[model samples]
Target: AQSVTQLDSQVPVFEEAPVELRCNYSSSVSVYLFWYVQYPNQGLQLLLKYLSGSTLVKGINGFEAEFNKSQTSFHLRKPSVHISDTAEYFCAVSEEKTSYDKVIFGPGTSLSVIP
Candidate 1:
């Protein structure tokens, strides 16, 4: 079984400020990590992923994350944020050997960017 935790439910940040959304996962078997963004009235979009390769993974809209095997964490970070970046972010994980659709998602972190 796999479970994900997003420590903060809401994150408020000033526009153009650096922000980091924390995410941690627990799984006995090796798994693939992912970050997804969901805007109002929209479906989840893939922000980044760590399927195997480099530890540092970059995604669209200047978002990036590092896969830490020992820490069991994959925290999303952006040097500068934009007002349009405000949305709900989800951390997800699924067993590597299992179906990709059988993923476990975290509650979510709602990012609010203030101008």
Candidate 2:
């Protein structure tokens, strides 16, 4: 079984500041890591993904994350954020070689950017 945990439920930050969202996962098999962002009342959009190869992965809007195999964690980070960056972030994992027909999502970290 695979499960993902997002440590923060919400992260409030001022515009142009930095932010980080932590995530941890538990799985007995190989897994694929992903971060998704969702605007208000909108569907989730793929921010980044770590399938294999490199541990560090960059995504849209200057967001990036590192996959730590030893810790089973994939944390998202951004150096500077904008009010438009305010949205819900989700971390997810899926077993390797398995179809993502039943992917699971974290509770989500609500990012509120203050102007």
Candidate 3:
């Protein structure tokens, strides 16, 4: 079984402040990790992924995450946040290699960047 956990359900921050979203996962087998962002009334967009590469992965909008195999964690971070960055973020995991593999997503972390 594979599962994802987002420690914080909601994060509030002032504009231009730094923020971090914590995520953890558990899988019985090798897995692929990903972080996705969802804007209001829109589908999710891939933020970053940890397929098979260096632990550090950068994503759009100045977001980045580090894959810690030992801890089974992939925490997303941003140096500075803007009001436009307010959105829901999801952490996901997949155990299969094919594109058709099922992905398990965390409950999602809502980021509220105040102006």
The models' CA-based lDDT, in order, is 0.95, 0.93, 0.93
Tens digit of lDDT per residue, candidate 2, span 30-90? 8898999999999999999999999999999999999999999999999999999999999
Write the residue-wise lDDT of candidate 3 on 1-115 in tens digits.
Answer: 7889999999999999999999999976778999999999999999999998799999999999999988999999999999999999999999865433699999999999999
Q: Model 3: number of clashes?
A: 0
Tens digits of per-residue lDDT for model 1, 29-92: 8999999999999999999999998999999999999999999999999999999999999999
- Pairs of residues at least 3 apart in sequence or in different chains that clash in candidate 1: none
The CA lDDT at 44 in model 3 is 99
- The list of candidate 2 runs beyond 4 A from truth reads 98-100
Residue pair clashes in candidate 2: none
Worst lDDT 10-window in candidate 1: 95-104
Model 3 bad stretches (over 4 Å)? 97-100
Error of 2 at 78 (Å): 0.4
Measured with C-alpha atoms, the lDDT of residue 1 in candidate 3 is 79
- Compute each candidate's TM-score over C-alphas: 0.96, 0.95, 0.94
